[model samples]
Target: MFISFEGIDGSGKSTQARLLAEMLRLQGHDVVLTREPGGSPGAEEIRRLVLEGDPDRWSAETEILLFTAARRDHMERTVLPALAAGKIVITDRFADSTRMYQGLSRGDLRGIVDQLHGLMIGREPDLTFVIDMDPAKGLARAKGRNGHEERFEDFGEGLQSRMREGFLALAREFSGRCRVVDGDRAPEVVAEEIAEIARKSLAWTQKA
Candidate 1:
């Protein structure tokens, strides 16, 4: 199973991803936990350049392309092989972040992102869990984690709102494969809800 967890920064994606992987492992299932833009060495380098550098160094198109570059590498080097080996892959963030960040946040680059996504991930996630949260709440948690904010995370209210809307749009567009979970709840509660959803989805897939 290839499952992805997505949401705005500080939406508890990483925490829930780890928890889901752990639960799957405890069930004697082989599982791999990873994240986008930094899953592989090459992708990690791209991540640093994209997230840590001066904002002006890259245009919206450049950002979309770089993100796609990293994603291509990550898919080739990590995601595909694991799935072929029968290991469940749980990713903290995936192509949706690129669409939301560079496409929606930056505007005018969604076509570029969509083309890259089709080229890279020919098949979308078997199941995508979108952890939805308020922008202010999510950003506050994100800032607390780093004691500072990265360039993308520093977009404040306007951009954050757009990003959240973008996520919802993607979820609606792929409703059959995407499930939005209320992330405003406690972390443990969210994890439990996600696990149940994953369990049910896995069963449904097998029967199909």
Candidate 2:
């Protein structure tokens, strides 16, 4: 089984991803915890190029290509092999992020994003947890970290708001595998909910 955590910056998806991975590992599941743009050596290089620069450093079209390239490398080097070996893969973010950040944040270029995704990286997570949070709150949490990868956070609350909406819309669009979890509660509370859902998913997968 493959799982992905998606949300605006500081929505706690990363923490949730980690928690889920640890929990699953405790249950004797072989789990590979990774993140996009930095899962592989080649992808790690691209991560710095795209994530550490200025927000306007790359155009949306250019970002789409760059992200797709990184994702392809990540899949080839890390994701595919893990899944083939019968491990559960969990990633911090995935192509849904690209579909929002580069596709809708700038202009209506989802077509381009989708085209590239289908051509290069055709796999989607078997389960996706879209951690939902308020835009302003999410931005504040993100900025509080003072991390270097503030390129997207630097885009301001407006972009975060739009991205939040885009993610929610995306959940509806891909409802089959997407689950929206409110992130306003305490971390343990959120993690418990996610773990329960994940356990149910695992049981279903096994029965199938």
Top candidate, metric TM-score: 2
Clash count, predicted structure 1: 0
Cα-based lDDT for every prediction: 0.86, 0.96
Model 1 misplaced stretches (Cα beyond 4 Å)? 147-149
What is candidate 2's local distance difference test score? 0.96
Q: Cα deviation in Å at residue 110, candidate 2?
A: 0.3
lDDT of 2 by residue, 70-110 (tens): 99999999999999999999999999999999999999999
TM-scores for all candidates: the values are 0.95, 0.99
Pairs in clash, predicted candidate 2: none
Which 10 residues in a row give candidate 1 its minimum summed lDDT? 147-156
